[model samples]
Target: MTHRISCELAEAPLAPGEVAIVGAGPGDPGLLTLRALSLLEQADCLVFDRLVSREVLALASPKARRFYVGKASRCHALTQEQTNALLVRLAGEGRRVVRLKGGDPYIFGRGGEEGEVLIAHGIRFRVVPGITSAQGCAAYGGFPLTHRDHAQSVTFVTGHRKGDGELILDWSALAVPHHTAVFYMGLANAGTISRQLQAHGLPASHPVALVERGTTPEQRRVITCLGELVATIAREGLTPPTLIVVGEVVRLADTLAQPAAQVAILAEGEIRDRVGERVAL
Candidate 1:
């Protein structure tokens, strides 16, 4: 049997004079939200980063024009001024623009800066939340952000700074109680992080999880403790675009790794009394 190619995009529609900063969701095309897909479908022009997956780009309507602003790991990204100007110019031409990023737009993705520019220009814009690498990586790597008995609160932080010269993270603060702590773009600083966190009182043996490539088929997850995490990642040859998670919840990640299973158990065990059959297994 032969399958026919449909030029139709599975994206959604958009209104005129509006800009959508969409999260492409940690390199997995399926993680695209319905609203995000809609904006892509109706987008007259898409300003995307070089790191965006081809699969996600392919979802934009066939008629929509695609522009690459070229922001990749260790590569040249357009100046912030130029990028913001491009967005304004595109919208000035009455094009429905989609600023698509590799993961969630807000989580270290620079969507806030773009939003500031839009506000200054009085351009209408919307925010579309997508699965950040933290969520995506943790899910695909079998690490749960929270475990009932293990953790209660989760924190997300960036490991590197664009302008800062050194590892300037607040080590003392991060060493506090947490169910999980996720560090984005942190693979390169894994060693420094380990040393600093340990120096700040975080146990050297605290479990650390490094998820590379996140939700993609090429994804890899390394489960190790802080003391050995650096050596383990180096010996194993993992690359950037990775997330680092540290905490007690990681110890129970094996059991809560299943999305459907976690939901089911939460429903049947915890919410049964208050939510009744609504949460019934």
Candidate 2:
């Protein structure tokens, strides 16, 4: 059971004052790339968000300077402006900084905004992409974003906004079948999300999956129809780090899953083989 967790691909040199915007992946240390972990090994300063798991943080060098600038709904440890300034300041100090975000940096992780600051300040940076929670959670929750028979395309959207602003999503359009919707940073809007979808012509019985802290030991998944999702999550008392998925694909978890105890063994062998073959299409 001694699987190699990391590789020798990156122990290379950095371009002196380079600052890399790396994703920590969806709260799973195993999903991190060799390059990312290697960078963390040498990072002089580590700036991470609250969504970054402590497990991943432990992998950084003991000498690294840790800065927790975590941000999310209900908790904004650092303002957007502050984060931008922090990145510029960190780079100015000639520190090898790693901006670790949960999930993919490019997927609603506000990475573009930070990149803009780096460009303005003439800081050399590279983006190391990681798995977004939507994609990660879907796979772990046994729901594919797109199954040939279930969907042709998948769209990821944020269901809520700052300042309690009304959602600007085109509900009538979004409610249509055949397209899967993945919502990130949407824990507080479960009720509204469900009601809006229903008002917009989506059937009340449309399948939905809510995955909390997905891909980790504490992961919780609720499979329900559109009619009861909001109420169900409330009843179950699930908290943040939740991702919502709506589509026929949510109905496939049981069908896609093997018996409970065989998952790890399956993941090491037949599961990947079968999925790899199927994915080749």
Best candidate according to TM-score: 2
**Candidate 2 regions off by >4 Å?**
1-12, 259-281
TM-score for model 2?
0.87
lDDT at residue 210 of model 1 (Cα atoms): 76
All candidates' lDDT scores? 0.76, 0.79
Task: Please estimate how well model 1 matches the true structure, expressed as its whole-model Cα lDDT.
Answer: 0.76
TM-score for all models, in order of appearance: 0.83, 0.87
Q: Write candidate 1's Cα lDDT for 1-281 as tens digits.
A: 52223324453345577788989888777777777776776788999986587878987778888888876455656876899999999998888899998888898889999999999999989888888888877776666788776668888898876655787877887886665788887787888889988898888889888777766655666678889888887776777777889998776655555556334224323311101112222
Model 2 lDDT, residue 231, Cα: 78
Kindly state the number of residue pairs that clash in model 2: 1
